[model samples]
Target: MEIISNEALSRCIRDAVRAELQEHFKTGGSTGNVSRERLLSKQELAAELGVSLVTLTEWMKKGLPFFRLHKRVYFRMSEVLETMQQKI
Candidate 1:
Protein backbone atom coordinates (compact mmCIF):
# COMPACT_ATOMS: atom_id res chain seq x y z
CA MET A 1 0.00 0.00 0.00
CA GLU A 2 1.24 3.46 -0.82
CA ILE A 3 0.50 6.34 1.58
CA ILE A 4 0.92 10.02 0.77
CA SER A 5 1.88 12.70 3.30
CA ASN A 6 -0.89 15.01 4.62
CA GLU A 7 0.74 18.09 3.08
CA ALA A 8 1.00 16.39 -0.32
CA LEU A 9 -2.67 15.37 -0.18
CA SER A 10 -3.77 18.84 0.84
CA ARG A 11 -1.70 20.46 -1.91
CA CYS A 12 -3.12 18.06 -4.51
CA ILE A 13 -6.69 18.76 -3.40
CA ARG A 14 -6.10 22.52 -3.44
CA ASP A 15 -4.59 22.42 -6.91
CA ALA A 16 -7.49 20.40 -8.28
CA VAL A 17 -10.07 22.77 -6.75
CA ARG A 18 -8.19 25.81 -8.02
CA ALA A 19 -8.03 24.39 -11.52
CA GLU A 20 -11.76 23.65 -11.46
CA LEU A 21 -12.58 27.14 -10.25
CA GLN A 22 -10.36 28.66 -12.93
CA GLU A 23 -12.14 26.68 -15.59
CA HIS A 24 -15.53 27.63 -14.21
CA PHE A 25 -14.66 31.30 -14.18
CA LYS A 26 -13.09 31.11 -17.59
CA THR A 27 -16.39 29.88 -18.98
CA GLY A 28 -18.44 32.43 -16.99
CA GLY A 29 -19.71 30.02 -14.32
CA SER A 30 -21.95 26.93 -14.37
CA THR A 31 -24.69 28.36 -16.62
CA GLY A 32 -22.14 30.12 -18.83
CA ASN A 33 -22.08 33.80 -19.94
CA VAL A 34 -25.60 33.98 -21.39
CA SER A 35 -28.27 31.97 -19.60
CA ARG A 36 -31.09 30.92 -21.91
CA GLU A 37 -33.28 29.87 -18.97
CA ARG A 38 -35.63 32.65 -17.93
CA LEU A 39 -36.22 32.89 -14.20
CA LEU A 40 -39.87 33.37 -13.18
CA SER A 41 -41.12 35.22 -10.13
CA LYS A 42 -43.25 33.34 -7.58
CA GLN A 43 -46.50 34.86 -8.83
CA GLU A 44 -45.53 34.33 -12.46
CA LEU A 45 -44.74 30.70 -11.86
CA ALA A 46 -47.91 30.12 -9.88
CA ALA A 47 -50.00 31.64 -12.65
CA GLU A 48 -48.16 29.75 -15.37
CA LEU A 49 -48.69 26.45 -13.54
CA GLY A 50 -52.37 27.32 -12.96
CA VAL A 51 -51.95 27.05 -9.20
CA SER A 52 -52.52 29.48 -6.36
CA LEU A 53 -49.76 31.16 -4.42
CA VAL A 54 -50.63 28.99 -1.42
CA THR A 55 -50.23 25.80 -3.43
CA LEU A 56 -46.92 27.01 -4.83
CA THR A 57 -45.69 27.70 -1.35
CA GLU A 58 -46.73 24.22 -0.28
CA TRP A 59 -44.91 22.74 -3.27
CA MET A 60 -41.79 24.69 -2.33
CA LYS A 61 -41.97 23.15 1.14
CA LYS A 62 -42.46 19.74 -0.46
CA GLY A 63 -39.15 20.03 -2.40
CA LEU A 64 -40.28 21.86 -5.50
CA PRO A 65 -37.17 23.29 -7.11
CA PHE A 66 -36.64 27.00 -6.37
CA PHE A 67 -33.98 29.56 -5.61
CA ARG A 68 -33.78 32.92 -3.84
CA LEU A 69 -31.81 35.83 -5.16
CA HIS A 70 -31.84 39.48 -4.03
CA LYS A 71 -34.36 38.52 -1.37
CA ARG A 72 -36.85 37.28 -4.00
CA VAL A 73 -37.90 33.80 -5.01
CA TYR A 74 -37.48 32.50 -8.56
CA PHE A 75 -38.08 29.27 -10.50
CA ARG A 76 -37.21 27.87 -13.88
CA MET A 77 -40.29 26.40 -15.60
CA SER A 78 -38.36 23.39 -16.91
CA GLU A 79 -37.06 22.52 -13.44
CA VAL A 80 -40.47 23.02 -11.88
CA LEU A 81 -42.07 20.70 -14.43
CA GLU A 82 -39.29 18.15 -13.97
CA THR A 83 -39.70 18.20 -10.19
CA MET A 84 -43.47 17.89 -10.44
CA GLN A 85 -43.08 14.94 -12.78
CA GLN A 86 -40.68 13.27 -10.34
CA LYS A 87 -43.15 13.77 -7.50
CA ILE A 88 -45.79 11.97 -9.51
Candidate 2:
Protein backbone atom coordinates (compact mmCIF):
# COMPACT_ATOMS: atom_id res chain seq x y z
CA MET A 1 0.00 0.00 0.00
CA GLU A 2 1.27 3.44 -0.94
CA ILE A 3 1.01 6.27 1.56
CA ILE A 4 -0.29 9.55 0.19
CA SER A 5 0.91 12.89 1.50
CA ASN A 6 -1.58 15.43 2.80
CA GLU A 7 -0.89 17.87 -0.04
CA ALA A 8 -1.34 15.16 -2.65
CA LEU A 9 -4.60 14.00 -1.05
CA SER A 10 -5.91 17.53 -0.86
CA ARG A 11 -5.04 18.20 -4.48
CA CYS A 12 -6.81 15.02 -5.56
CA ILE A 13 -9.95 15.97 -3.62
CA ARG A 14 -9.93 19.48 -5.05
CA ASP A 15 -9.51 18.21 -8.58
CA ALA A 16 -12.34 15.75 -8.14
CA VAL A 17 -14.67 18.42 -6.81
CA ARG A 18 -13.75 20.79 -9.62
CA ALA A 19 -14.48 18.14 -12.22
CA GLU A 20 -17.84 17.31 -10.63
CA LEU A 21 -18.82 20.98 -10.50
CA GLN A 22 -17.77 21.48 -14.09
CA GLU A 23 -19.95 18.59 -15.13
CA HIS A 24 -22.82 19.82 -13.00
CA PHE A 25 -22.66 23.28 -14.52
CA LYS A 26 -22.22 21.93 -18.01
CA THR A 27 -25.49 20.09 -17.52
CA GLY A 28 -27.16 23.13 -16.05
CA GLY A 29 -26.85 21.96 -12.44
CA SER A 30 -28.45 18.63 -13.22
CA THR A 31 -27.27 15.06 -13.36
CA GLY A 32 -29.09 13.87 -16.51
CA ASN A 33 -30.99 15.35 -19.44
CA VAL A 34 -33.62 17.13 -17.39
CA SER A 35 -34.86 20.67 -17.15
CA ARG A 36 -32.42 23.13 -15.67
CA GLU A 37 -33.05 23.56 -11.97
CA ARG A 38 -30.52 25.45 -9.95
CA LEU A 39 -29.98 24.37 -6.38
CA LEU A 40 -30.24 27.14 -3.81
CA SER A 41 -29.01 27.25 -0.27
CA LYS A 42 -31.38 28.11 2.55
CA GLN A 43 -30.18 31.70 2.63
CA GLU A 44 -30.41 32.17 -1.11
CA LEU A 45 -33.89 30.69 -1.32
CA ALA A 46 -35.14 32.86 1.54
CA ALA A 47 -33.73 35.96 -0.11
CA GLU A 48 -35.06 35.06 -3.52
CA LEU A 49 -38.52 34.39 -2.14
CA GLY A 50 -38.43 37.62 -0.13
CA VAL A 51 -39.09 35.69 3.05
CA SER A 52 -37.33 35.50 6.37
CA LEU A 53 -35.32 32.52 7.52
CA VAL A 54 -37.91 31.72 10.13
CA THR A 55 -40.61 31.63 7.47
CA LEU A 56 -38.49 29.36 5.34
CA THR A 57 -38.01 27.08 8.33
CA GLU A 58 -41.74 27.00 8.81
CA TRP A 59 -42.22 26.11 5.18
CA MET A 60 -39.78 23.27 5.58
CA LYS A 61 -41.75 22.02 8.55
CA LYS A 62 -44.88 22.15 6.40
CA GLY A 63 -43.31 19.78 3.85
CA LEU A 64 -41.62 22.11 1.44
CA PRO A 65 -39.29 19.97 -0.59
CA PHE A 66 -35.62 20.07 0.30
CA PHE A 67 -32.60 17.85 0.52
CA ARG A 68 -29.60 17.65 2.82
CA LEU A 69 -26.01 17.12 1.93
CA HIS A 70 -23.11 17.21 4.35
CA LYS A 71 -25.46 18.56 7.00
CA ARG A 72 -26.34 21.46 4.69
CA VAL A 73 -29.85 22.04 3.32
CA TYR A 74 -30.59 22.69 -0.34
CA PHE A 75 -33.73 23.48 -2.30
CA ARG A 76 -34.38 23.26 -5.99
CA MET A 77 -36.08 26.36 -7.31
CA SER A 78 -38.41 24.45 -9.61
CA GLU A 79 -39.60 22.19 -6.83
CA VAL A 80 -40.06 25.07 -4.45
CA LEU A 81 -42.10 27.00 -6.98
CA GLU A 82 -44.26 24.00 -7.71
CA THR A 83 -44.81 23.35 -4.05
CA MET A 84 -45.78 26.94 -3.47
CA GLN A 85 -48.21 26.92 -6.36
CA GLN A 86 -49.84 23.83 -4.98
CA LYS A 87 -50.12 25.38 -1.58
CA ILE A 88 -51.77 28.47 -3.01
Candidate 3:
Protein backbone atom coordinates (compact mmCIF):
# COMPACT_ATOMS: atom_id res chain seq x y z
CA MET A 1 0.00 0.00 0.00
CA GLU A 2 1.23 3.49 -0.91
CA ILE A 3 0.46 6.76 0.90
CA ILE A 4 -1.01 9.61 -1.15
CA SER A 5 -0.66 13.29 -0.15
CA ASN A 6 -3.73 15.44 0.46
CA GLU A 7 -3.08 17.47 -2.69
CA ALA A 8 -2.75 14.32 -4.80
CA LEU A 9 -6.01 12.93 -3.39
CA SER A 10 -7.78 16.22 -4.03
CA ARG A 11 -6.50 16.34 -7.60
CA CYS A 12 -7.62 12.77 -8.20
CA ILE A 13 -11.10 13.53 -6.90
CA ARG A 14 -11.33 16.69 -9.03
CA ASP A 15 -10.24 14.86 -12.16
CA ALA A 16 -12.77 12.08 -11.52
CA VAL A 17 -15.56 14.61 -11.08
CA ARG A 18 -14.52 16.49 -14.21
CA ALA A 19 -14.47 13.31 -16.27
CA GLU A 20 -17.88 12.28 -14.97
CA LEU A 21 -19.31 15.70 -15.85
CA GLN A 22 -17.77 15.53 -19.32
CA GLU A 23 -19.24 12.11 -19.87
CA HIS A 24 -22.62 13.34 -18.68
CA PHE A 25 -22.47 16.24 -21.13
CA LYS A 26 -21.50 13.94 -23.96
CA THR A 27 -24.50 11.74 -23.15
CA GLY A 28 -26.88 14.71 -23.14
CA GLY A 29 -27.60 14.13 -19.48
CA SER A 30 -26.37 17.49 -18.19
CA THR A 31 -27.78 21.02 -18.26
CA GLY A 32 -24.72 22.68 -19.78
CA ASN A 33 -26.41 23.83 -22.99
CA VAL A 34 -28.87 26.68 -23.33
CA SER A 35 -30.27 25.47 -26.63
CA ARG A 36 -31.81 22.50 -24.84
CA GLU A 37 -34.47 24.28 -22.86
CA ARG A 38 -36.24 22.01 -20.39
CA LEU A 39 -39.79 22.25 -19.18
CA LEU A 40 -40.04 22.58 -15.42
CA SER A 41 -42.87 21.74 -13.05
CA LYS A 42 -44.67 24.56 -11.25
CA GLN A 43 -43.21 23.42 -7.94
CA GLU A 44 -39.74 23.34 -9.45
CA LEU A 45 -40.12 26.83 -10.91
CA ALA A 46 -41.47 28.19 -7.65
CA ALA A 47 -38.52 26.75 -5.75
CA GLU A 48 -36.12 28.01 -8.38
CA LEU A 49 -37.53 31.56 -8.20
CA GLY A 50 -38.04 31.49 -4.44
CA VAL A 51 -41.74 32.10 -4.88
CA SER A 52 -44.82 30.31 -3.64
CA LEU A 53 -47.02 28.07 -5.72
CA VAL A 54 -49.90 30.48 -5.25
CA THR A 55 -47.79 33.28 -6.69
CA LEU A 56 -46.94 31.17 -9.68
CA THR A 57 -50.60 30.45 -10.18
CA GLU A 58 -51.29 34.18 -10.05
CA TRP A 59 -48.61 34.74 -12.63
CA MET A 60 -50.27 32.13 -14.81
CA LYS A 61 -53.54 34.02 -14.48
CA LYS A 62 -51.65 37.20 -15.43
CA GLY A 63 -50.39 35.59 -18.67
CA LEU A 64 -47.26 33.72 -17.71
CA PRO A 65 -46.68 31.30 -20.58
CA PHE A 66 -47.19 27.65 -19.69
CA PHE A 67 -48.05 24.37 -21.29
CA ARG A 68 -50.79 22.13 -20.04
CA LEU A 69 -50.92 18.50 -20.98
CA HIS A 70 -53.86 16.90 -19.25
CA LYS A 71 -53.89 18.36 -15.70
CA ARG A 72 -50.12 18.94 -15.44
CA VAL A 73 -48.52 22.31 -16.12
CA TYR A 74 -45.02 22.90 -17.43
CA PHE A 75 -42.99 26.05 -17.98
CA ARG A 76 -39.88 26.48 -20.07
CA MET A 77 -37.04 27.99 -18.03
CA SER A 78 -35.89 30.24 -20.86
CA GLU A 79 -39.39 31.54 -21.52
CA VAL A 80 -39.99 32.16 -17.83
CA LEU A 81 -36.70 34.08 -17.56
CA GLU A 82 -37.51 36.12 -20.65
CA THR A 83 -40.98 36.92 -19.40
CA MET A 84 -39.69 37.93 -15.98
CA GLN A 85 -37.09 40.18 -17.60
CA GLN A 86 -39.76 41.81 -19.72
CA LYS A 87 -41.87 42.38 -16.64
CA ILE A 88 -38.94 44.09 -14.92
Candidate 4:
Protein backbone atom coordinates (compact mmCIF):
# COMPACT_ATOMS: atom_id res chain seq x y z
CA MET A 1 0.00 0.00 0.00
CA GLU A 2 1.23 3.53 -0.89
CA ILE A 3 -0.12 7.00 -0.10
CA ILE A 4 0.68 10.38 -1.70
CA SER A 5 0.50 13.53 0.42
CA ASN A 6 -1.37 16.57 -0.97
CA GLU A 7 1.44 19.04 -0.10
CA ALA A 8 4.14 16.95 -1.80
CA LEU A 9 2.04 16.51 -4.93
CA SER A 10 1.28 20.25 -5.10
CA ARG A 11 4.99 21.17 -4.74
CA CYS A 12 6.04 18.75 -7.46
CA ILE A 13 3.36 20.03 -9.84
CA ARG A 14 4.27 23.66 -9.14
CA ASP A 15 7.96 23.03 -9.86
CA ALA A 16 7.17 21.16 -13.09
CA VAL A 17 4.88 23.97 -14.33
CA ARG A 18 7.53 26.58 -13.55
CA ALA A 19 10.18 24.65 -15.51
CA GLU A 20 7.87 24.32 -18.52
CA LEU A 21 7.02 28.04 -18.46
CA GLN A 22 10.71 28.92 -18.36
CA GLU A 23 11.36 26.84 -21.45
CA HIS A 24 8.42 28.39 -23.28
CA PHE A 25 9.48 31.95 -22.51
CA LYS A 26 13.14 31.26 -23.34
CA THR A 27 12.37 30.88 -27.05
CA GLY A 28 10.30 34.08 -27.30
CA GLY A 29 12.37 36.42 -25.16
CA SER A 30 15.41 38.44 -26.17
CA THR A 31 18.82 36.71 -26.40
CA GLY A 32 20.71 39.64 -27.89
CA ASN A 33 23.19 42.22 -26.59
CA VAL A 34 21.53 44.91 -24.48
CA SER A 35 24.04 47.58 -23.49
CA ARG A 36 25.94 50.15 -25.51
CA GLU A 37 29.65 50.85 -25.08
CA ARG A 38 30.05 54.48 -24.11
CA LEU A 39 32.91 56.79 -24.91
CA LEU A 40 34.49 58.55 -21.93
CA SER A 41 34.13 62.32 -21.66
CA LYS A 42 36.15 64.72 -19.50
CA GLN A 43 33.90 64.15 -16.51
CA GLU A 44 33.84 60.38 -16.90
CA LEU A 45 37.56 60.25 -17.54
CA ALA A 46 38.21 62.19 -14.34
CA ALA A 47 35.94 59.88 -12.32
CA GLU A 48 37.57 56.76 -13.73
CA LEU A 49 41.05 58.00 -12.86
CA GLY A 50 40.01 59.35 -9.45
CA VAL A 51 40.82 62.90 -10.53
CA SER A 52 38.68 66.02 -10.63
CA LEU A 53 37.62 68.06 -13.65
CA VAL A 54 39.59 70.94 -12.19
CA THR A 55 42.72 68.76 -12.24
CA LEU A 56 42.04 67.88 -15.88
CA THR A 57 41.69 71.53 -16.70
CA GLU A 58 45.01 72.18 -14.99
CA TRP A 59 46.64 69.41 -17.04
CA MET A 60 45.35 71.03 -20.20
CA LYS A 61 46.62 74.39 -18.98
CA LYS A 62 50.04 72.83 -18.46
CA GLY A 63 49.82 71.13 -21.91
CA LEU A 64 50.20 67.61 -20.61
CA PRO A 65 48.49 64.56 -22.26
CA PHE A 66 45.57 66.02 -24.21
CA PHE A 67 44.02 65.29 -27.58
CA ARG A 68 42.78 68.05 -29.89
CA LEU A 69 40.91 66.90 -32.96
CA HIS A 70 39.36 69.47 -35.36
CA LYS A 71 39.32 72.15 -32.63
CA ARG A 72 37.65 69.81 -30.13
CA VAL A 73 39.21 68.18 -27.08
CA TYR A 74 39.43 64.42 -26.51
CA PHE A 75 41.38 62.06 -24.27
CA ARG A 76 42.70 58.62 -25.11
CA MET A 77 41.37 55.72 -23.07
CA SER A 78 44.78 54.05 -22.98
CA GLU A 79 46.31 57.21 -21.60
CA VAL A 80 43.68 57.38 -18.89
CA LEU A 81 44.32 53.76 -17.91
CA GLU A 82 48.04 54.45 -17.76
CA THR A 83 47.49 57.54 -15.63
CA MET A 84 45.30 55.56 -13.26
CA GLN A 85 47.90 52.83 -12.91
CA GLN A 86 50.78 55.22 -12.44
CA LYS A 87 51.64 56.73 -9.05
CA ILE A 88 51.00 60.46 -8.61
Candidate 5:
Protein backbone atom coordinates (compact mmCIF):
# COMPACT_ATOMS: atom_id res chain seq x y z
CA MET A 1 0.00 0.00 0.00
CA GLU A 2 1.21 3.53 -0.75
CA ILE A 3 0.44 6.70 1.17
CA ILE A 4 -1.08 9.56 -0.81
CA SER A 5 0.73 12.89 -0.64
CA ASN A 6 -1.11 15.93 0.73
CA GLU A 7 -0.91 17.71 -2.62
CA ALA A 8 -2.34 14.71 -4.46
CA LEU A 9 -5.17 14.38 -1.96
CA SER A 10 -5.99 18.07 -2.24
CA ARG A 11 -6.03 17.91 -6.02
CA CYS A 12 -8.32 14.87 -5.96
CA ILE A 13 -10.75 16.61 -3.62
CA ARG A 14 -10.74 19.77 -5.75
CA ASP A 15 -11.40 17.85 -8.92
CA ALA A 16 -14.26 15.92 -7.32
CA VAL A 17 -15.86 19.10 -6.06
CA ARG A 18 -15.55 20.76 -9.46
CA ALA A 19 -17.19 17.82 -11.19
CA GLU A 20 -20.03 17.76 -8.68
CA LEU A 21 -20.71 21.45 -9.16
CA GLN A 22 -20.68 21.12 -12.95
CA GLU A 23 -23.23 18.30 -12.77
CA HIS A 24 -25.33 20.26 -10.32
CA PHE A 25 -25.47 23.28 -12.58
CA LYS A 26 -26.19 21.21 -15.64
CA THR A 27 -29.22 19.48 -14.13
CA GLY A 28 -30.31 22.57 -12.21
CA GLY A 29 -30.68 24.73 -15.31
CA SER A 30 -33.89 23.06 -16.47
CA THR A 31 -37.08 24.99 -15.66
CA GLY A 32 -39.38 21.98 -15.33
CA ASN A 33 -37.21 20.25 -12.78
CA VAL A 34 -38.64 21.09 -9.39
CA SER A 35 -36.24 19.00 -7.33
CA ARG A 36 -33.13 20.87 -8.42
CA GLU A 37 -31.91 22.46 -5.25
CA ARG A 38 -29.98 25.71 -5.45
CA LEU A 39 -28.94 28.08 -2.72
CA LEU A 40 -29.49 31.82 -2.97
CA SER A 41 -28.12 34.57 -0.83
CA LYS A 42 -30.57 36.91 0.83
CA GLN A 43 -29.88 39.65 -1.70
CA GLU A 44 -30.40 37.29 -4.61
CA LEU A 45 -33.66 35.99 -3.21
CA ALA A 46 -34.95 39.47 -2.58
CA ALA A 47 -34.11 40.50 -6.12
CA GLU A 48 -35.73 37.37 -7.53
CA LEU A 49 -38.94 38.10 -5.64
CA GLY A 50 -38.81 41.82 -6.45
CA VAL A 51 -38.89 42.60 -2.76
CA SER A 52 -36.71 44.68 -0.49
CA LEU A 53 -34.21 43.16 1.91
CA VAL A 54 -36.31 44.50 4.75
CA THR A 55 -39.33 42.72 3.37
CA LEU A 56 -37.33 39.53 3.07
CA THR A 57 -36.43 39.78 6.72
CA GLU A 58 -40.09 40.14 7.47
CA TRP A 59 -40.81 37.03 5.44
CA MET A 60 -38.21 35.14 7.42
CA LYS A 61 -39.96 36.10 10.59
CA LYS A 62 -43.15 34.82 9.03
CA GLY A 63 -41.61 31.37 8.49
CA LEU A 64 -39.59 31.36 5.31
CA PRO A 65 -37.16 28.46 5.35
CA PHE A 66 -33.57 29.64 5.61
CA PHE A 67 -30.18 28.40 6.59
CA ARG A 68 -27.56 30.33 8.55
CA LEU A 69 -23.87 29.63 8.40
CA HIS A 70 -22.06 31.99 10.75
CA LYS A 71 -22.93 35.49 9.50
CA ARG A 72 -24.17 34.30 6.13
CA VAL A 73 -27.75 33.34 5.35
CA TYR A 74 -28.99 31.22 2.45
CA PHE A 75 -32.37 30.37 1.06
CA ARG A 76 -33.20 27.28 -0.95
CA MET A 77 -34.99 28.41 -4.12
CA SER A 78 -37.24 25.35 -4.40
CA GLU A 79 -38.40 25.54 -0.80
CA VAL A 80 -39.09 29.24 -1.06
CA LEU A 81 -41.25 28.81 -4.09
CA GLU A 82 -43.16 25.97 -2.48
CA THR A 83 -43.79 28.04 0.62
CA MET A 84 -45.07 30.89 -1.50
CA GLN A 85 -47.47 28.55 -3.30
CA GLN A 86 -48.83 27.20 -0.03
CA LYS A 87 -49.31 30.68 1.35
CA ILE A 88 -51.08 31.82 -1.76
Candidate 6:
Protein backbone atom coordinates (compact mmCIF):
# COMPACT_ATOMS: atom_id res chain seq x y z
CA MET A 1 0.00 0.00 0.00
CA GLU A 2 1.20 3.52 -0.73
CA ILE A 3 1.34 6.01 2.15
CA ILE A 4 1.67 9.80 2.24
CA SER A 5 3.73 11.68 4.87
CA ASN A 6 1.87 13.48 7.71
CA GLU A 7 2.30 16.96 6.20
CA ALA A 8 1.17 15.81 2.78
CA LEU A 9 -1.86 14.10 4.29
CA SER A 10 -2.76 17.24 6.27
CA ARG A 11 -2.40 19.43 3.20
CA CYS A 12 -4.62 17.21 1.12
CA ILE A 13 -7.24 17.10 3.89
CA ARG A 14 -7.15 20.89 4.25
CA ASP A 15 -7.54 21.39 0.51
CA ALA A 16 -10.54 19.05 0.36
CA VAL A 17 -12.15 20.76 3.37
CA ARG A 18 -11.59 24.20 1.83
CA ALA A 19 -13.13 23.10 -1.45
CA GLU A 20 -16.22 21.79 0.31
CA LEU A 21 -16.59 25.01 2.29
CA GLN A 22 -16.27 27.10 -0.88
CA GLU A 23 -19.08 25.16 -2.51
CA HIS A 24 -21.27 25.54 0.56
CA PHE A 25 -20.67 29.28 0.68
CA LYS A 26 -21.41 29.65 -3.01
CA THR A 27 -24.57 27.54 -3.26
CA GLY A 28 -26.03 26.73 0.13
CA GLY A 29 -29.19 28.75 0.50
CA SER A 30 -30.51 30.27 3.71
CA THR A 31 -31.52 26.92 5.18
CA GLY A 32 -30.64 27.61 8.78
CA ASN A 33 -30.48 30.16 11.60
CA VAL A 34 -29.72 33.02 9.25
CA SER A 35 -33.44 33.27 8.55
CA ARG A 36 -34.04 33.87 12.27
CA GLU A 37 -32.12 37.10 12.28
CA ARG A 38 -33.22 40.33 13.93
CA LEU A 39 -36.57 41.96 13.31
CA LEU A 40 -36.81 43.24 9.80
CA SER A 41 -38.79 46.36 9.00
CA LYS A 42 -41.68 46.09 6.57
CA GLN A 43 -39.57 47.74 3.92
CA GLU A 44 -36.81 45.26 4.54
CA LEU A 45 -39.28 42.39 4.18
CA ALA A 46 -40.44 43.76 0.86
CA ALA A 47 -36.84 44.01 -0.28
CA GLU A 48 -36.07 40.46 0.75
CA LEU A 49 -39.18 38.96 -0.89
CA GLY A 50 -39.23 41.39 -3.77
CA VAL A 51 -42.67 42.64 -2.81
CA SER A 52 -44.01 46.14 -2.29
CA LEU A 53 -44.53 47.78 1.11
CA VAL A 54 -48.31 47.75 0.77
CA THR A 55 -48.29 44.08 -0.09
CA LEU A 56 -46.15 43.38 2.93
CA THR A 57 -48.51 45.24 5.25
CA GLU A 58 -51.49 43.49 3.77
CA TRP A 59 -49.89 40.11 4.29
CA MET A 60 -48.90 40.98 7.84
CA LYS A 61 -52.29 42.42 8.78
CA LYS A 62 -54.05 39.38 7.41
CA GLY A 63 -51.74 37.08 9.36
CA LEU A 64 -50.91 35.38 6.11
CA PRO A 65 -47.27 34.88 7.11
CA PHE A 66 -44.50 36.53 9.13
CA PHE A 67 -43.61 37.07 12.76
CA ARG A 68 -44.96 40.14 14.48
CA LEU A 69 -44.35 42.02 17.72
CA HIS A 70 -46.74 44.93 18.27
CA LYS A 71 -45.70 47.26 15.44
CA ARG A 72 -42.55 45.32 14.65
CA VAL A 73 -42.10 42.37 12.33
CA TYR A 74 -39.51 39.66 11.93
CA PHE A 75 -39.04 36.17 10.53
CA ARG A 76 -37.68 32.85 11.67
CA MET A 77 -35.84 30.72 9.14
CA SER A 78 -37.61 27.56 10.16
CA GLU A 79 -41.07 29.12 9.86
CA VAL A 80 -40.36 30.26 6.33
CA LEU A 81 -39.08 26.86 5.34
CA GLU A 82 -42.12 25.13 6.80
CA THR A 83 -44.48 27.50 5.04
CA MET A 84 -42.74 26.88 1.74
CA GLN A 85 -42.95 23.15 2.28
CA GLN A 86 -46.65 23.38 2.98
CA LYS A 87 -47.21 25.31 -0.22
CA ILE A 88 -45.54 22.57 -2.14
Best by TM-score: 2
For model 2, residues 1-88, the per-residue Cα lDDT tens digits are: 7699889999999999999999888976766667556789999999999999999999999999998999999999989999999999
How well is each residue in 1-88 modelled by candidate 4, as lDDT tens digits?
Answer: 6487889999999999999889869865445653233446777777877889899888768554566667666676766556646736
lDDT of 6 by residue, 1-88 (tens): 6588889999999999999888877866455555435566667667887889887677666554676688677765455557657767
lDDT, candidate 5, 1-88, per-residue tens: 7599889999999999999889878976565745556689999999999999999999999999999999999999889999999999
User: RMSD to native for every prediction?
Assistant: 7.1, 6.1, 11.1, 15.2, 6.0, 10.1
Q: How many residue pairs clash in each candidate?
A: 0, 0, 0, 0, 0, 0
lDDT of the structure predicted as candidate 2: 0.93
Q: In candidate 3, what are the lDDT values of residues 1-88, reduced to their tens digit?
A: 7699889999999999999999988988855554567789999999999999999999999989999989999999889889989998
Clashing pairs in 6: none
Q: Tell me the whole-model lDDT of each prediction, alpha carbons only.
A: 0.91, 0.93, 0.92, 0.70, 0.91, 0.69
Where does candidate 1 have its weakest 10-residue lDDT segment?
27-36
Model 4 residue runs over 4 Å out of place are 1-39, 81-88
lDDT of 2 at 69: 95
Q: Tens digits of per-residue lDDT for model 1 on 30-73?
A: 65355568999999998898999999999999999898998999
* TM-scores for the candidates: 0.61, 0.61, 0.59, 0.38, 0.59, 0.40
Residue-level lDDT for 49 in candidate 5:
97
* Model 4 TM-score, all chains together: 0.38
Query: RMSD to the native, candidate 6?
Result: 10.1
